[model samples]
Target chain A: MDFFSQWVAFQTIVTKEIRRFTRIWVQTLLPPAITIALYFVIFGNLIGSRIGTMNGFDYIDYIVPGLIMMSVITNSYSNVVSSFFSTKFQRSVEELMVSPVPNYVIIGGFVTGGVCRGLAVGGIVTILALGFADLKLTNIFVTLSVVLLTAAMFSLAGFINAVYAKSFDDISIVPTFVLTPLTYLGGVFYSISLLPDFWYNVSLINPIVYMVNGFRYGILGVSDVSLWVTYGMLTLFIVSLYTWAWYLLSRGIGLRQ
Target chain B: MSSALKISGLKKTYGNTFEALKGIDFGVQPGDFMALLGPNGAGKSTTIGIISSLVNKSGGKVEVFGKDMDTQPYECKLDIGIVPQEFNFNQFEKVGNILKTQAGYFGIKPGLAEERAEKYLKLLGLWEKRDEMSRMLSGGMKRRLMIARALVHEPRLLILDEPTAGVDIELRRSMWDFLREINEQGTTIILTTHYLEEAEQLCRTIAIIDQGEIIENTDMKSLLKQLDKETFVLDVQGDLEKVKSIQGYRINLVDEHCIEVEVSKGQTLNQLFSDLSELNIEIISLRNKANRLEELFVSLVENKGAA
Candidate 1:
């Protein structure tokens, strides 16, 4: 197929995926909006008042970027994992597989869909956060860059998880066990600087830490790590995860017999 | 005539064992309606999968319209469409979106894709249910939806693997008519069916695969001709409790109303009728005991097994 056709294929897949999630808005879109609203109410308002200021800002303001980044990361990862795995379960992935659509196009399309949902939820959560905390952006470029790269990286990760998934249970295992723990420990509720030297050092090993901190730096100009190292790590993760996902698709692992 | 699809030494092995296709070879001429008949586990699905690029082949070559599959798989896939035996579409999707999405996968523009989707949906009797979710469709409608989806891109070659497996007789006949129209209009078709009568009525050429091998591949007429004898069940008007020995025929009393007769090649039915009439037995009607091709297929597979 020509480049134009590949583009069309990619657009079709992304559109279908978007339609799928939007069609079930109550499940895909509404739940996250409600969940993040509760987070803002409980963590940012109710408890934040007593916690006072952290990082030279109100506790709610300090956690706003982290909350938005959390939403982006979780939504992006779950979207691809669920959508791709459902396609495999229904065997509808064969529709693209049997067609002349390239593997990269397939991977690109699903990841784009994931990114869309992640950013969409992120946007929704940010709006909800405004009611509880004062939100401001220190660096628009860094904020957008970090959020986009983080979403892309997790989308790729989700694709990898879906490819290896044999059942619905398999799809949820990583998100529930690996993802939630990392995101919570990655400084979504509090900055890791408050922790002791040992725990802070251990927290540094969590990848989500860089992503949340980078995004936090973007929004409030506060970060525990160097922005350069954060950007480098995010770029490296995105490229590596994308390449790995593409490799799995090309090899037809867990897809073709 | 040029071949629409050519397979030479095609093979597939599952998990480094359990060979599914043992280097099978066959070809279909452009515009010819051919049947690939086999029993279960006879590698029919494997062949269809390989052609459609759903299954990776372990060895050999496949060419679609002279395009080498290994080097030019996308181009080759562009020329072929497949309706697999199983329901593989998203059940939650509206009937129309499935077809439209399939067209898009082939890089069709939205406008043209809508037109084509409309055309096929109407042709397959699915236009009325275009807005309904696919999961709501009955078995037959779902099958027709699959056919419409496969034809959305107007592929040059169409492959149907048991396309009418669960379809009612009326729907199956209509599907055959639709398929014939496409084949007549220059689309090469390869159909895999368990219904031997379906093959006899539709396909001009036939390939019988068994035990991962093509035991017989020839024209339908020639394959039927390979049957040395045809067994027919005759309804007799009068009952006669006697055994008659015909020199070149085998006759048996199935019951009071029916008698089975095996007529060998070069034998005349006229002589048998005359002999029965002389014995005061009136013949009401007669029909073949089994589909002609079914008999050939059974014996061929059995003989291959014995060998």
Candidate 2:
């Protein structure tokens, strides 16, 4: 198909996906806002009052960026995994496979959908955080780029997960076991500087740490890691994950017989 | 004129042991209404699956309107539409959205997609239910929705796998009319159906597959002619107390008011009517005891099994 045609196909998929999530707002959009609001109240207001400050910023302000990034990460990952796997379960994915739409367009469309949901939930969380803490952005470029890139990278990760998923249970295993642990230990609630040198080095290996700190630096101009290293790691993960996801889709793993 | 679809050496093997299709070959000419008939597990679905790109082929070549599937899949896909045996659409979507969404997947513009969706939904008698969720549609309506969705892109070739599997007789006949209309308008149609009567009434050509092989591929009339004998049932107005021994014909008293007569090739039905009249049996109605193609299909498959 030509460029115009491919674009139309891509737009169709994205629109369908968006409609799917939005149509079920109680399930997809509402929970994140309510959950993040509780986090702001309990962690930001209650626990934060007891803990004075971390990394030279108020405890609530220090955790705001991390909290927003965490929402972005989980929301983005779950959206694609659930939507794509549901498409497979319903056998609706064959609609695209049998059509003339190219493989990259399929992957690109779903990833864009994932990114949309991720940023949407992230935006909601950011607005909720404002009610509890005085949030300010030190760099709009860094803040927006980090959030966008992180959502995209995790969306690709979720796409790969959906491609190999045989059942609904398989889609959630990674996020619950691997993703939850990584986000918690990724210095979301505290800085790695608070850890001992050995554990601090170990924390560097978790990819979510760079994303959290990158956003933290963007919001408060304070980062435990260098911006250069954070940007480099995010770029590497995005490119690698995207290429691998594209390969899996082209191979038709867990899709075609 | 170019063929609408051509398959050569097509093969499919499931896992390591089951061979669904064993290097079969067939061609569907433009404007030809053909039936690909087979019993259960005879590779009819496998062939349809491979052509629609739902199943990966183990070996062979498939070309749609002279475009090779391997190299020009997009071009080929653009020319063919498939209505699978089962419902594979999103039940949550509105009836109209399903067709429009399907057209969009083929890269059709929203305006044209809407137009095509409207045209087909109306043609399929689904215009009033356009905004209703697909899950609410009845069985026959759902089947019609699938047909409308397949035609939204206006493909050159339309393939339907048992499109009327469970439809009522009246709806099935209407669907047959719609299919014939499309074929008349230059769309090549390939249908797979378990109903031999449906095939006999609609398809001009027929292909029968059995045990992963094409046992018969010929015109419908030629295949029907292969049946050496045809049994027909006659309902009589009065009760017959005993069987009549007709010297030249084989006849059986099915009941008091019905009789079955076996007619051999080259036998004249007028002769049997004359013989029955002489026997004082008044015929109320006459009909084939079984579909002609059905007899041929069963015998062909049985012979292939014996071989």
Candidate 3:
């Protein structure tokens, strides 16, 4: 099939995946929103009252984008991992295997599903953040671009995880050991400028730093790294991951018999 | 007829030193019903897996309808449908949706998918089960559902792997009729089974695999004819022990007053009868006991490695 037709097929799989999540709104869509709200109550209200603003915004405003981005990363990653793994477990992946659909369509269909869940949770978290902080968007394009890049990156990561995973335990290991640490140190609640120089330098290594700052630059017009560098790094990360993902898919890495 | 599939030196070896397929070659022609017969772990599933693109091959090549799989898989795959031995449909989805989604994988539109799904489900006696989750279906129904899902796109080559292994005899016959109807309609079918009778009744050509090698591949009748040995059951007037001295024959005592002897073709039964008569064993009845198809199937896989 041509690119246009393949994309239409990808769209169908994506819609089915999205409907699966939306149908279970209580389990998938609602939990993260509520969790972020709880974070706002304890971390922003109770905790921020003692320490004044570090980035010249209220503690609630400072943490909003980071929390939302974190939710997006986890949701997008989890959605693909769980969904793809379930297909593998149930042997339903053979449906695509037996068809003439190219490997790229399978990857595109699955990654888009992850992106939808990520964006859905991110969007819901944004609404929750709205009630807590008076946030503004100085650059709409940068804000949307950074959010989308983050989604694409994590969704691709999730796709890779699902491909290599043999069992349910294999999917959970990265989230617990790798992803949680990266998100915690990504400068979510605090600016790197407030940290010691060594720690601040180390923070630059986290890919999430560029994304959080990129979105922060879009909304608050204040950022630690130059917006270009953040945008450049995020773009590079997305391309490199996408290329690797496509290569793995084309070779039928863990999907083939 | 031109070959529908041609395989040459196909091999698959995993990273863990497990060799699943060891350079096997076979072919099937258009509208021919071919059966791959083997014991479990005889590489039947692995062979089907590689053909359907589910398994990665380590070496060699496969061509479908004259197109090399590695060069233009889409051109080859467009006409092929694989009904895997295992149930591979989504248990969470309704049967109708499962079949429709499979059609969509081939870029077929929803309307076309629906029409095709209805046609297959109804034909398979599963139209009412359309709304039920696939996991809820019985084992036989689920197997039929796999066939329906495979043919939703009207593929020209249908590969059925053990389609009716565990089903009842009646259902097995019904499935054979159904498959034969499709085959008559110009769908070349490649079936793999441990059930030799299924092959005897359905396939025109048969290949027997044992210990990762194609031991035999020929017309079904030819393979059966190779066993030109005849076996007969004799109902003797006297005790069975009296017939033990038949010259140039192996005697098997079925029960008292009856003895079964195996003789090479054209080696006269009259010779054995007279030899027994010299031993004072008079027979009341004589019956042929050789099932040639079974004999061929057994002798091929009888721990003798390759034929």
Candidate 4:
């Protein structure tokens, strides 16, 4: 295929992926909105008032970046995992497998769809956060870069999960056990500075903490970790995960008979 | 003319054991309609899967329109299309969307994709259900939908794995007509079907695979000619009492009005009709006791098993 043809194939897959989630917006989009809204009401407005300020900002304000990042992480990961796995289960991925579309085009298209949904939900949750606290972006470039890179990273991770998943249960296992725990301990609700030194060091080992703190740095210019290190870690994860997913796809792992 | 598809020394083994295909070799000339026949557990599906790149081959060389599939898979894939035995489309998608999405996979522009989708849908009698979700369509419609999807790209070679399985006879005949028309228009087709009559009616070349090997690969006429005798059931207009061993024909009286005749090669049916006429018996109708191809297929497989 020529460059134009490859581009068209990529666009087709992305459009189909977007249409699939948007068509079932009640199931895919609405729940995240409601969940984020509830978090704002209960965690931000209700309990944040009692907690007062942390890290030189109001409790609600400090957690806004973390919550928004969390939404992006979870939605982006789930979107690709569920969509790709469903195709595998239905055997409809054969449509793409037998076509002239390259594996990279397929992978790029799904990741693009995941990023779109992630950014969308993150935007919605940001709007919801506005209802609880006045939030401002300290650095627009850094904020956009962190969210985009994080979404891409998790989207690639989801693709890998889908590739290895033998059943639907396998897809959720990572999210339920590894992802949820990592997100909570990543300092979504509190600064790691409040933790004992030993726990703070351990929290630093969790990848999500750097993402949350990097995004926090982007939004408020305050981070528990160095901004340079956070950016480096995000880039490293994205590159490695993308390379691994591509390898798996080219090998036809968990797909071909 | 160049061959439409060529396979040389193709082989596949599942895991560490279970050899599915063992060094099978064949080729289909451009514009030829060929049948890849086999019983369950035969390597027909495996060969088709390897050609379509759905299943990786353990060893072999496959060329589509002279392009090596291993090296130029994208180009080879673009030149061919496949309708698998099972329904593989998204059931939740609209019929039109399914075809359009398939066209898109081939990098077809939206306008052209729409036009081609409309053409195939209408040809396959699916235009009316274009707006309906695919799952809502009946079984036959779903099968037709798969055909339309496969044809959306207008591939030069089309591979159908049991395209008419479970379809009613009427629909099956119509599908045969459609397939014949396409083949006449210069599209090479490779079909795998359990119905031997379907192969006899549509394909000119036949390849029978069994026990991971191609046991028979020849022209249809030549394969049928391998049968030494054919059984025919005749309905007589007058009462027939007893079986008679006529010269060069073995006859059995099935009932008062029916008789079975086994005609060997080099025997003329005209002589039997003459004898029946002399007996004051009129022939109402006559038909083959079994599909000629079915008999040939069974004998070939049996011979291979015995060997």
Candidate 5:
């Protein structure tokens, strides 16, 4: 297919995907906003009053970026995993597979859907965070770039998960076990600087730490890791995940017999 | 003058041991309505799956309108539309959106996609339910929706795998008419159906596959001609005691009112009717004991099993 044709196909998929999530706004959009609202109320207002400043910032403000990153990660990951797996479950993915659209277009379209949802829910959570704690721009470029990369990376992760998933139950296992734990431990609620030496070193290995700390740095002008290290981690993860996803799709793994 | 579809030694093996399609080869001329008949596990679905790129081929070549599938799969897929045996579309999507989305996948623009979606939906009697969720459609309506979705791209080669497997007789006949209409309009159709009567009524050519091999591939007339004799049941309004035998045909009394007669290729039913007339029997109604193609299909598959 020509480039223009592929673009149309890609746009069609993205539109369908956006319509899918928006059509079920209660399930896709509302729950994350409500859940993050409660987190801000309980953790930021109620709990942060007891804890003093960490990393030279108020406890509530310190946790805002982490909370936003968490929502983005989970929402982005869940959107692709659930949507793509549902497409496979219903066998509607065949509609794309049988068409003239290339594999990259398919991947690009779904990833865009995931990114959109992630950013959307992220925006909602950020607005909610403002009511509990004041948030100011530390570096608008860093903030936008880190969140975008994080959402795209996790969306790709979810796509890979959906591809290998055989059953609906299989789709939930990764997010519930791997993603939830990784997000909680990735310096969402605490700074790695507060951890014991060995554990602080271990937390550095968790990829989500880079995202959370990077976003925190973007928001608060403070970070446990170097800006260069954060960018390198995000870039490396995005490139590797995108390439891996493209390879799997081209090979027709999990999607075809 | 390129064939609409051509399969050369097409092969598919599932896992390590199960060979779904074994070096099958066939061709459908442009605008030909071809029936691919087979018993269960005979690789009919496998061939369709491979052609639609749902299943990977183990070996050999598939060419659609002279476009090599391997070298130009997008071009090949662009020319063909397939309706799988199972309902493979999203049930939650609106009926109209299903057709529109399908057209979009083929890179159709919004304006033309809307026009074609409307065209096919109306053609298949789905216009009223266009905005309704597809899952709410009845079985027959769902079948029609699939047909409409397959046509939105206006493909030259349309393949339906058992399109009317469970449809009521009336709806089945209507679907046959719709399929025939498209075939008449120059879309080559390859249909796989368990209903031999459907095949006999709609297809001009036939291919019978068994045990992953094509046992018969010929025009429908030629395949039917190979049947040495045709058995027909006659409902006669007379007592069996009045009739003893027929002259040139093998006759058996099925019941007091019905009798089965095997008429050979060179024989005439006029002779049997004359003999029945002599017996003072009045023919109420007469019909074939089985569809001609059904008999041929059973015999062909049975012979393959025996071999």
Candidate 6:
């Protein structure tokens, strides 16, 4: 199949993917929204009432961007990792591999699903954030663009993780070791400006910091770094990760016997 | 000019030195059921994998219905469907949905896909399990479901790898009946199975591959004739064969009740029985020694002493 037919297959894959997660909506889509709500209540309203603002914005508002972005990051990563690994575990991947579908189509199909799930959970959490505070979208285009780019980037990351994964343990290792650290140091709860000079310079190299702040700049109209630079970094990461995923798939990575 | 599958000089050497298929070549005639029979390491699955474009070939050319697989894969692969040895359908999906989704994979539209899905599912006895999760289906049902999914496209050439493995005898027999009907209606089939009896019963032509090479490829009757050149078992009442005289047969006194002899296919057991009668020995019974092909297969792959 060429690009158009593959695009159709991609649509089927995304719909199936959305259905897979949504079929057990209480476990998949609801958890992130509820978790984001809890974050707002405990960290935004209860705790922010004492900590005050670090980025010249109200504490509740500052944390809202991070909480929403966190939803995007975790949901996107988990969605692809779990779905791809389950397909492999069930040995159903051979069904797709033998078909006329190209490797890129398979990659596009799964990654797009992850991005949709990520952005979807992010969108739901964003709506839930409205109940806590007046959420801002200073630039609707930027917010939507950055949210999509971040979702794509993390979804690609999750796909690569799935390719290298052998078991359920392999899926969780990256999230626990890499993703958790990245999200925590991602300038989600606090600004990089609050870090000491050396620590601030160290945090500059962290990719998630740019993603969170790019989203921050999108939502609240404030950022610690250049918005263009954040967009540039996100664009680069998206290409690099997607390219790596396609390469792994073409190589059959861990899939072929 | 009329081959359903054409493979030429295919090789697959993985991870440097392990060459699974070392330059193999064959073709399946259209509307024929060709059985690929081989020992464990004879590279049947690798060949199937390459033809289906799942495993990348190290070297060679393949064409389906005369279309080059490399240059125009989609057109070549569109007419072929593969049913692997293992269960590969989506277990979480229903039997109906799995077939429908598989049809959609081939760009078959939804309405037509559903119609085809229902037809194959009903034919495979899976219409009853249409709404049930595939993981909940029995193993035999899953096997049938795989066949349904493969046939949803109404493929012209079907490749089944061990389609009857691990299946119960009743299901296996019925499945063979179903496949025979399909092949009679002109769907070419290439099946690889460890069930020699299945191959013997279904395939008109058989190819015996050993160590990545085709050792013998001939009509199934001719292959069976290799074993008909056979063994003779003598059932005598008492100790008799202390003295044995037979030119074309190797005779042995196994015990008081029996003697074993290997003879050429054209040699008659009655001739030996009459010869024993001339010696005043009463014959009790006579039977062929080895199974039709088991002895020949053993002698071919093992028992090199005969060669």
**What is the docking quality class of candidate 4?**
high
Estimated TM-score for each candidate: 0.99, 0.98, 0.91, 0.98, 0.98, 0.90
Cα error, residue A227 of model 4, in Å, equals: 1.6
Clash pairs, model 4 backbone: none
Model 2 lDDT at residue A65: 96
- Looking at model 1, residue A65 earns an lDDT score of 91
Of the pair 1 and 3, which is ahead by DockQ? 1
Error of 4 at A169 (Å): 0.9
Please provide, for model 1 over B1-307, each residue's C-alpha lDDT reduced to its tens digit, 9 standing for 90 to 100: 5589999999999999899999999999998899999889999999999899889899999999999999998999899998999999999999999999999999998899999999999999999999999999999999999999999999999999999998899999999999999999989999999999999999999998998999889999888888999999999976456436445679988888899999999888999998888778999999999999888889998888899
Query: Candidate 5: which pairs clash?
Result: none
Which tens-of-lDDT digit does each residue in B69-161 have in candidate 2? 999999999998999898888989999999999999999999999999999999999999999999999999999999998999999999999
lDDT of 6 at B15: 87
Sort order, TM-score high to low: 1, 5, 4, 2, 3, 6
DockQ, 0 to 1 scale, candidate 6: 0.52
* Tens-digit per-residue lDDT, A159-257, candidate 6: 899999998999999999999898999899999998899999999999999989988998889899999899999999988988899898877878875
Calculate the i-RMS of every candidate, to one decimal place: 0.7, 0.7, 1.5, 0.6, 0.8, 1.8
Report the lDDT tens digits of candidate 2 across residue range A20-70: 889998998899899888888888889989999998888999999999999
How far is A10's C-alpha from truth in model 5 (Å)?
Answer: 0.8
Q: For candidate 4, write residues B147-242 as lDDT tens digits.
A: 999899999999999999999999999999999999999999999999999999999999999999999999999999998999999999764752
TM-score of chain A of each: 0.98, 0.98, 0.96, 0.98, 0.98, 0.97
Model 1, position B97, has a per-residue lDDT of: 98
Model 6: CA > 4 A from native: A2-4, B231-263, B268-291, B303-307
Per-residue lDDT of model 5, residues A77-196, tens digit only: 999999999999999888888888988898899999999999999998998888888899989999999999999999999999999999999999999999999999999989999999
Q: After superposition, how far is residue B230 of candidate 1 from its true place, in Å?
A: 0.2
Q: Give the per-residue lDDT digits (tens) of candidate 4, residues A58-83.
A: 88899989999999999999999999
